[model samples]
Target: MSRHNIPDALWQRLEPLVCLPRKDPRGRPAKDARLMFNGVLWILRTGAPWRDLPAEFGPW
Candidate 1:
């Protein structure tokens, strides 16, 4: 309903795929992997800048 045009279904599938594997080689915690994946998808889908993503979804 906002300027964010990424589809809901596409995002749903991507959410889990993006959230997993958050562990780093050194066991360091990763930031919101979900947001990162979503950002990348958004860029590819809508060609929008990563910095332009909504604050509520968090940053890439």
Candidate 2:
């Protein structure tokens, strides 16, 4: 896990709260919720603009 990523303990709690999309006859699939959540956390944790997010988060 990356240092900036969510910890498993916290993720266990958070994972239950997110609703993911199914791939059945849908539009573009949603990105991985874990990564997206981590990306959001990264920005909030760093207090940085979304454009300034690290590349490790992928195309912020």
TM-score of each: 0.41, 0.71
Q: Which 10 residues in a row give candidate 2 its minimum summed lDDT? A: 19-28
User: What lDDT does candidate 1 reach at residue 52?
Assistant: 76
Over the stretch 1-60, how does candidate 1's per-residue lDDT look in tens digits? 344445678778766765666445676565755455555666777777777766766754
Q: How many residue pairs clash in each candidate?
A: 0, 0
Which numbered prediction scores highest in TM-score against the true structure? 2
* lDDT assessment of candidate 2: 0.82
Which regions of candidate 1 fall more than 4 Å away from where they truly are? 1-28
Cα RMSDs, all models: 4.1, 2.6
| Local lDDT at 47 for model 2 | 96
